[model samples]
Target: MMVLLISTSIMFSCKEKANVLKESIEADIIIYGGTSAAISAAVEAKRSGKSVIVVSPDKHLGGLTSGGLGWTDTGDKSVIGGLAREFYHRVYKYYNTDEAWQWQPKEEYGNTGQGTPAMDGENRTMWIFEPHVAEKVFEDLVKEDSIRVDRDEWLDRENGVVLEGGNIKSFSTLSGKTYSGKIFLDATYEGDLMAAAGVSYHVGREGKDVYGEEWNGVQTGVLHHKHWFESDISPYVVPGDPSSGLLPRVSAENPGEKHSGDDKIQAYCFRMCMTDHEPNRVPFPKPDGYDPMQYELMARVFDTGRKDWFQKFDAIPNHKTDTNNHGPFSSDNIGMNYDYPEASYERRKEIIKEHEQYQKGLLWFVANDPRVPKDIQLKMQKWGLAKDEFTDNGNWPHQIYVREARRMVGEFVMTENELLKKRKTPNPIGLGSYTMDSHNVQRYIKPDGFVQNEGDIGVETNGPYTISYGSLVPKKNECKNLLVPVCVSSSHIAFGSIRMEPVFMILGQSAAAAAVLAINENTTVQNVDYNKLKEVLVAKGQIVE
Candidate 1:
């Protein structure tokens, strides 16, 4: 929360020792993220014998892998080679020993999206795992690589540093640390470093016309799942009443263009960590600013004898589950984070608090309310947070599942067609394959007083799609020495697939590998000889198919 102010009388240059007005540290490569990608890139840099340091905003790294997305969304497993594949193997090793499963039986936690033991052992590639386990794997990589890591240091983007010719001379952080490196990589989900480096990035969803993407903007009536109520859905603006007033949080304005897109982005939420064991369970506390009216749809669903209230808890290792929003008014904090991608830190903090309250309140209403269905209440009441996980933060996970965010408009913008396997790029740097999934953008009331959700759409993009190198690097003129891995240049639908934790790791490694090559050769990141880069990547097991 404290920003170290920079002083006057600073003296420095790229080669000379910089007594930074703020604070100073010099390295060959400086990475600005705690994500798996950041770790991968830093490791790659170290393996190449480069001096590197990671200044992560998070105390813990691994992004979603540590965040709560234990069920990995991998496309073609074979395409998930190199560091991405190593990460999964590490998870398997964690579960290899019997002691890893203290809560649940080993057989129960087996077959977690990996290949089965028998029946020809299905030729699998992608790997899924537990949240803490993923964090451990990331930590192991840091330890094995002997990489220098500094946590909780946010970048001072506005007046951090600038380039004289084209390369990034240096950058500053809020924690009185100025990082000067020959090459820099922005591996954060928010693309903060990229934004600070003056690279162009888009915050909201772009129209289909803007990117020629079929799946771009505000999708209103397009249903992607079978969670909607079977009976007549009310749109009466009020619960049970034909006309009382618009329900709390329901948008009054119409979001036009069902097929095309808009500037509004999809929602985000923390994947709640819940356990069924009573010894480890902590009852859901009613969050401050709790509003029952916001969860009226949930009540309606429960009143109709709905037994599918817990459909979102995709069971993870032990007896724990990675819980996300299953249907209407679940954990996906619908319509509340429309401005989070580009919001200021204060504004973003407020949004996070609001989301935390909404999610916490939702759980409380379900667990303690008399209005909830008996069977659903009984089941929900059994679950609480695990005792052994996230010990520092009351067992609740620290990272929020930032689904999507500010994407750089780099040298090349990956589009839906590429992700859908419709087109091929000559400069393919990595591969990603996952369904184009977006959470609800807004909640609206129908004419019949029932709720109508907007923006939740899942389109399956078949095959291991090609990801362009330009997706990671900005146009040579924008910032030659800078690279972005998490929020790389890509269309909304395309980014949905590329935004996975594994792919970020792959791209992170690739970005740093390219950076080291660029540093060794006096050329822009654009001019790193692909053959030489590919050699190092292949040696590292990175699949650039």
Candidate 2:
């Protein structure tokens, strides 16, 4: 009797373990992210006749696209194709309706974009749109395809991924839900899944020598944008007194050698979706721990007769604006997010909150502070947060503009040479033509004890350059079944151009197609035939030139 009872207990224990490991949801492809790339990948996977699941960390769909980055950074609209171009076409269709324009009429919203018409009638595509409209388009894309999206499902980065023979077998989330798949795609901006999978990746800037690129690393005394302190402003709390202590936001450390390597990355900021319309404007709330002293440097910048505060308030539909970091001291919180790429989730939240507080405080200071120039203050006061956008998050964007992060060091690493037309890209999958841009990395005191900004680059590419297929796959030895579209394999300078949302969508579609081909051939993503992949890409409206 005792032996029989012990046997029963052992049997039950083994059964429970099996149940725990069993995947709650299984599919042909499992995508980890909620960004625009994730949506595009999921849609493509479904269109390819495969079961797909998106384990999204965010409740929302689009990352920065629907997160206040309405002003598209499209370099050459002609090169954008596949689902990416489809997205813009959907936007154009939405705006063609009478009800789409709520706060303003379609005629009043002029066809102004970044050197192109906002609504390109000939191509039936719209580049510029409001945040809510972008989100709706993303939501519709998923809904139309009937894609399974598990929202707010945070990946258990510590012990989630289960790999077998260089392939991911399954991964669990914080909710204890196991997801099994034939192939995996990491579409997050931070490359969380890629890093968690133990694939090789690099954070921050690589030295110019690392990739033989001119704009890869630390760039002191080289200011391409207007985001530098043109005037001689002292870094000290009290002007010309080093003993008085450094002012807030100004770094005390040594700005590294020019063109040398450093761990610093470009500054990040909330692309504030603001509106001057009285009916739909919500005043910028004073953040929880608002401090006026933080804006003293900004006030000093204004004192220098710089009236370009509203320079980057790029217009969108509905009388709204996609306000980005402009002048010397604006939205880009300089020198505050070095550890964000690899920080713990809790720590990242803290950092994001700090950025939010800093930006909100900056807006409040500009609108109400006595030190601000009366002319600028009056103009700023007219603008406020769009009442209808991001209503769940206090009318502030949920996604931060994480311009660059963990770039994978995979089988092929794109360099400035490829973008500059010096070296030809192999196994082209998509195209990118945006300027090799990087926001200011650090703000430090110059050799003469004056304040200055560093690491703001804006070198235009030769033209539309092809993106290599290898840039999306890992070295076969590292991870065979995993595909990374967002944090692609490229040098920092090259990633500057590839990090655009349209390119991400393009890569996402290409990655999904590659994943399906790999599954069909029973081979690794690295082993998928380039010719077969290119055929599918072109057939699916992807311009791979």
Clashes of each: 13, 0
Error (Å) of candidate 1 at residue 451 is: 2.5
Candidate 1 local lDDT, 326-433, one digit each (tens): 776578777788788777878988998888888888899999878898878888888887787777877777887888889999888998877776777657777887
lDDT of each: 0.78, 0.92
What TM-score against the true fold does each predicted structure earn?
0.91, 0.96
lDDT of 1: 0.78
Q: How far is candidate 2 from the true structure (C-alpha RMSD, Å)?
A: 4.8
Indicate the residue-level lDDT of 532 in model 2: 98
Among these predictions, the greatest TM-score belongs to 2
